[model samples]
Target: MIDLITAGLDWPVVVALLLTSCAASFITAAFGIGGGGVMLAVLASLLPPLAIIPVHGVVQLGSNAGRSVLFLRYMRWELFWPFAIGSVIGVAVGGMTVVQLDPGWLQIAVGAFILWTVFGKTPGIFKRSGPVAGAFSSFLTMFIGGTGPFVAAYVKAQDLERHSHVATQAVLMTLQHGLKSLMFGFLGFAFSEWAGFIAALIVAGFVGTWLGKHMLARINEKRFKLALNAILTVLSLRLIWSGVRLVFGI
Candidate 1:
């Protein structure tokens, strides 16, 4: 079983990643966001640099796909269609121009932007700018591996109900990560070697989502917003710290 699940990685590391996948999915499913960023950080720490983004994208694609399917009824199609269109364009451009530019500064900027958006009033342009948000976030995801906070901030600005917020964000992430995985495949990442490991993560994430769904049903809108903001704040701080570490070798 261990050999089937991993290639060169230690068994302990594989176990850790499986657990992280489950916990991260629970966080996102219950709160509407935060899991992808958390999972990305964990992957970056544990996985090879070349494997991190691609593997994270595949795991997230499965996690988000499950949530989107479970809450399909609440998705905001108007936002989805535009975001989908822009995502295709963004992924295309990103794949063509994908470079190993330092993501440290970008991470810092994204973290700061997320903090401001969560605490202050969002700009009028972002209130209904699905295509713009989708394009920009998708482009970044190709480099960063987790643009969920940015996309979640966009969805949050719409002032959706709890269910709608979670539902819409799930579908948006599903699309974004799906495109990213395909891009990585085209660029020649050997996903087949990681298939068993990835499948284990997806199954763990699904269990987490199922548990989170039950918890989400019991939370009220006001409390959900409070929790969501808190989670975003912590994630933003983590991003900033990670970026700083990368930039200065701290």
Candidate 2:
């Protein structure tokens, strides 16, 4: 992996990757959903398939950790335990069964679900049921890579304050990604093989998150939601397309 990255075949590609990491991290810090999904899509296209999920997990772990630290005080502690428990159960099932599933079909389903939400016709399912929402969303996250928007949609419907919203999402994401990283490790994903690149991406995410913290303070909550929804819609389309290509071998 390092050899491919360092072959000097094209410095522009490296620059683009770094830029994508920064943009995605900043979006994640500010909005809580775009970073991981965007980064995963771009990196999946560039890197080996074996490296995609683990590498994305590590980078997102750093990004969410930074967000959690910056907004620690605003986190809703009451929500953590149930959500964490559900996430653990969900990720375990997802990790164990994910390989048996067709990636293309999974992507299409996820993409369709996201689009349904973006269209504003989906009725609120989690607003009145916190535990159920936490458990199911966390489970879907294990297979989907990033489910922040679903969680955010629930929180929004409940009218959570901006700080609590960001903070709560950060906490949930941190738990999910941490568990994912551990699972990947046990499965022999070879973190050491991409240590240098992963380390660089983490540092880049850290810097992006730091900058995002400042911007988050100044941005209006409504505007942030609008931007997040827009980007997520775009990401959903891209993921769907990628899945189609993979499945059809076109």
Candidate 3:
């Protein structure tokens, strides 16, 4: 039973992963962004190199799916369809032409994109950024893993209410992570090796999302928005630094 739960990992890593999953879930549920990238960074440092992105995809799928289910009432289905359609097309292409890219270059591109999205002041862009953002994110995510910040940046530009923001973003991430997980499975990534750990993470994430809802109610809109932007900025900077180190082989 202990072997099953650890899935070849040490007990300490399993505990750390579970705790991070719960905390990351709370961040996403309460702030509607940042958690996925932060979780990916954490997992990257812990998991086997080849397994990082695919496993992260599955874990995030469960995490975001739980959040979406909890906030189902506020989901914006009308906007979701167009974005999902674009995502399907993008993912299809990604699935066909898949190759392991230079992780450094991928991080560089993602960081630059996130900074641009956060600091850019183009009102007209948000009006139609959904499909474009969806397509871009879905394709990139196939190669580099967590591009949730890109999608979140676009969603932030949409000016959604707090609850709607969390629900809608959760749904969108669910679609992306679901597609990525399917792609990984189809490509012969052995998810069974980590089944016990992933299941535990999902259960923890659900509880975290539930707890986060209570805190979400107390956070005012202004502070919530500020936190979202701040998280994006910090994550963007981290990505850039990681990219630079990898590119320089430092």
Per-candidate TM-scores read: 0.96, 0.83, 0.95
The backbone clash count of each candidate, in order, is 0, 0, 0
How far does residue 194 in candidate 1 sit from its true spot (Å)?
0.4
TM-score of model 1 relative to the true fold? 0.96
In terms of lDDT, model 3 sits at 0.86
The lowest-lDDT stretch of 10 consecutive residues in candidate 1 is: 1-10
Compared with the true structure, what per-residue lDDT tens digits does model 3 show for residues 1-250? Answer: 7776788998889989889988999888888787788789889899999899888999899999989888999998887988898798778878888465787988888888778877887456655767877887898898878788888887887788999999999999999999988988998999998888889988888888898888899999999999888998898888888888999988
Weakest lDDT window of 10 consecutive positions for candidate 3: 121-130
Off by over 4 Å in 3: none
Best candidate, lDDT: 1
What lDDT does model 2 reach? 0.73
lDDT against the true structure, each candidate? 0.90, 0.73, 0.86
Please identify which of the two predictions, 1 or 3, would achieve the higher TM-score against the true structure: 1
Candidate 2 residue lDDT tens string, 35-147: 87778878878877677777788778877888899889999888788777777777777778645667687777767777776766656655566666666665565555656
Off by over 4 Å in 1: none
Per-residue lDDT for 1-250 in model 1, tens only?
6766875789899889889999999999999998888788889899989999999999999999999988899988888988998899889888889366688988999899999999888988888788898898998898877889989999999999999999999999999999999989998999998998899999999998988888899999999999999988988888788889899999
Clashing pairs for model 3 are none
